[model samples]
Target: MVTIAIIGRPNVGKSTLFNRLVGKRLALVDDRPGVTRDRRSGEASLMDLEFEIIDTAGLEITGAETLEGRMRAQTEIAIAAADCVLFMVDVKVGLTPQDLDFAELCRRTAAKVILVANKAEARGAESGVLDAYSLGLGEPIGISAEHGMGMAELRDALVEALGEEAFADPLAEDEPEWWEEEAPELVAEGDEGEEAEAPPYDDTKPLRIAIVGRPNAGKSTLINRFLGEDRMLTGPEAGITRDSISVEWDWRGRKIRMFDTAGLRRKARIQEKLEKLSVADALRAIKYAEIVVIVFDVTIPFERQDMSIVDLIVREGRAPVIAFNKWDLIEDRQPVLAELREKTERLLPQARGVKAVTVSGETGEGIDRLMKAIVETHEVWNRRISTAKLNQWLSRTIGHHPPPAVAGRRVNIKYMTQVKSRPPTFMISTSRPEALGTSYTRYLINGLRESFGLFGVPIRLGLRKTDNPFAPKRKRPS
Candidate 1:
């Protein structure tokens, strides 16, 4: 599909237009300028026209060394890659000198350009729309990106620029693909096995992974290394990333969709509404992701906030792999890594045996190992043990370390069976479930992790009282 990119000076309602086109609030939008520093892409449709739309950082006129300048560079790159550019102008703000400057730059691009006069709903915006003609980019199409006005006209403009053929409908294809036709059959067959605990994972589906950490943990840098492209904006800046940007990539022929999220600071420190929104976006990414990679600054590894994030990931039931970033900065590697691993087990006992990879997102070190660990952790997260094996393990484990009696009554765990996989939930029928102590439950969880290789993932264990059918009927009397 043809890719169209939206470019304009800061706070020209670029993100609003992007969200309107994409039909989702994928990009971060605020009253402030430069809320968007990195370019975000999504599939968009205008009427019958289905195409890819890119939302880029506002173009700024600043020196190359500054943050605004870096944002400008990203916008330029977006313009270069796009098949068409939507050069947006704030008719409400009436086209600033910066808008004129960027218009010249857009005019020089090889891509097709369409001038968009935004905030056309406001009174006296027509003069600004008329003034946009002096930029020499042709008639400015009036649009209200915020109120959803002039979309039909905008669609007409896109059709005229790219032609109806460029907006090919994906549903036009007659034949159903192999995955659509046969993948469900494969899943059903695997699930029908006598000893099958969980259906085989569909490799054709992309793995959704979210990278999260405290501010300046190099989450974006690590993702850029994985993609082998500067897809994320990175710098010495602590909170450079604002939106949880999801990028599609392939590693070793495995499809991966990675979310680069904003740095999560403590709640007390987050004063601005924008930061709150960023944090919420990051959290949503974590909730939806199958695997979460918690990137840590090696120098400040296992900080309080880092542990909190890990606990959150655990509570979210996401498979986690700890990534110690900036390993190149560490002088003594072996002893440090060993100590870190020990600390990990102690501090994060809730997620015991979780995988930790030493990586340098800057110099591209240990990335291969990181990717391998991610895939392995995902498998472990989706692992299931058959009823026979689970019972056998439980019997052996109980024999070695039986549960202590509560109130002189023995609490007997009769049977256990895995109910589901993704994060591995199990149900146990017990004689006195309420009498089971937390320590004994922990012991059982640890045993399950050790016995079935269910490491690096959250395990859900539930207890239900075993009903005695022979002698447990109570008479209902008045």
Candidate 2:
């Protein structure tokens, strides 16, 4: 794909424009200048064109005596790799020397340049937009990226400069249409006469998993042990794993893709630009994983941050299993395990009956058990409950503990169906979904998890009020 890099000075709405073009908030946006420190790349489409768009660090030619020089180096690297450059200038500030310098740099690279004068929604910036012509780059496109103005003109400019044939709009929605068309091809070989064969589980396919935890946890060490080498540099340094590193390997005849994420610190400690990017990357990895194994240090297994991470995994509807790493360092095992179980129940009541396996990565003890837990969790993650069995369970559970009376009227939860699997989401149609309280939702979710043996896998319970289609619409009085 053609790579287009957005290069400019700080606080020129480059990140905002990046988010608008990509249709996702992959890059962080803040009022402060220089919020984006790292280069973030995403596939973007304009009209019929598809290409890779990179949001680069703001250009600042600080002398080689400071950290700003290092950041500038990173930006230069991105510019070198770009097929085209979107040279953004702030019309509000108008024609700074930095913009001119960056424009010169783009010219030297011999890459296609599209000069954009951002923050041009107000009438005051028209002269600045005109002034951008003197930079020797062609007429600058006046755009208010934050307000999403002038997108059509910007699209035309991109197509004209980059060639219209280079662009193609990517298939819309989360799932592509080609996947539906190719469903028959994805069927298993032996199941020709079956209604529709499920996709075969390829052992060669990477088993994507994330290792997540709080700062100072043994996440890095556990990852190193899993790989049987010091693949990731580890030390007494906390939060050393800054970015989520994808390490591929074959584990016991199964191809595994492990993401060693950075230690997620509290929001207060995440003031640094690099740390913020690291956290965002880790969250992205968690969302992309098939299974998430939260690695906590045995000494302090269920800290607030650790529980928060687990809660996030469950909320995202991903299969999660807790791994107590550094177990060899723990002095008291039984009491600690008992307390940990109790805390897990209290803190993660949503993930009731989730499995927590104790393992010492340093000694390789209990590694087999951890692997077994992972396979079992994977099975539950992919499990689909039959409609008949689900409704039966729902009926029995509601019968045992009925929903509370709402304002002298009793609410009725009619039918339940497994909407989707891969964390096993269920949709329940009810007479009054809005009246269902948090306590009641927990009761149903717990019952579903316990009855369906969905331990260690996140179970989602969605409540929807069934609309009465047969009921006549109210007629307006003439």
Candidate 3:
């Protein structure tokens, strides 16, 4: 697919156009300049054209050491990689010196530049749109990115710039069609006569992983290391990342879609509306991600906010892997590692046996191990136990430590079956479900975790009263 990069000065509606093209609010948008720091991409469709659209940081002229300069470097990189560039300018504000400087940049760098005069719906924007021709980038496409105007003309311009052949689906010729492939056969039973588990997870499917933690926990730093580039805007500053930027890349031939979310701060500390929105985006990432890497600063590991994030992940039923980031910063490795292990088990008992990896985001240490752990944890999260195996285990467990009697009447555990996997959930029928205490449930859950190797991932256990066949059914009033 053709790759198009949107570039311009800050607050020129570059992100707005990106969100419009992607048909979703993937990038963070605000009236404030330079809200977007990192370059984000999404699959976009405009009429018949299908392409990959990149949302870049607003171009600014600054020194290489400055944050704005780093952002500009990313945009320049995007411009180089892109087949076409959409040079957006706020027509309402008219073309400024900054716009002119970037226009010269687009002409010099991008192969095909499309001048997009945004906010065209506003009054007096027509004169500003007309003034855009001074940059010498051909007739400007005047459209309101916020109002979704002039998309058809923009599509035409794109087709004209990059031949229509560029829009053709590359997969048609390069890869086998998904629908043409043979369907997988379902197995009813296993070799030992146990119930058949769900088919193995599709390796071809991209694994969705989200990196989350409190502010300045090295979430973005870790992801940058993974990509082997400064893909995310990272620094010593806390909360530099405000949007849940997702990047799709192959890790050891396995497709991985990793989301770098904003650092989550306590509610009282998040006084600004923008911060609130950023936190909300992070929470959304946690819910959608199949596996979540809760990053921790090695120096201040497992703070109150960190534990709260862990609790949130468990409650959301996401498979979690703990990453002790900034390991290079630690002076004594052995003692810190041992202490972290002890604290992990004691403080995060809910997610008992959670996999923890010590890593340095700055030096790219332990990344391979972390990725391997994530994959393994995902397998465990999606693991399903056969009904026969569950029943056998239940029987032995009950025999060893039966449920305590409720009102002198023993609560009988009847049957157990796995309803689903993906954070494996089970339904248990009992003679007195209400009478069964939380302690017994916890015991059963722990047993399941240990027995099935469901460490770290959340396991759901629900109780239902057994239906008595001998009991007469209530007659319907007809």
Best by TM-score: 3
TM-score of each: 0.93, 0.58, 0.93
| Better-scoring candidate (TM-score), 1 or 3 | 3
Better of 2 and 3 by lDDT: 3
Q: Where is the poorest 10-residue window by lDDT in model 3?
A: 178-187
lDDT of 2 by residue, 1-478 (tens): 6788898999999989988888877677777787665566776765556678888667898985454555567677778888788899999889999988888988898379899999999779998999999888898999998888988888888888888766644544576522121221222323322423234434444478888888778877787788896555466657656656666677878878778787887788678777788799899889878889898887866777888888889889888888988888878888988888888788887677777889887788877888778877888887776667777888888888999999999988887776666767778889999898999998887777778787777877888888798989889999
lDDT of 1 by residue, 386-465 (tens): 77788899899999999989888888888887776768988888999888988899999988888888887999999988
Off-target runs (Cα >4 Å) in candidate 2 are: 1-205, 473-478
Checking candidate 3 for backbone clashes, the offending pairs are none
lDDT of 3 at 53: 97
Report the Cα lDDT for residue 342, model 1.
88
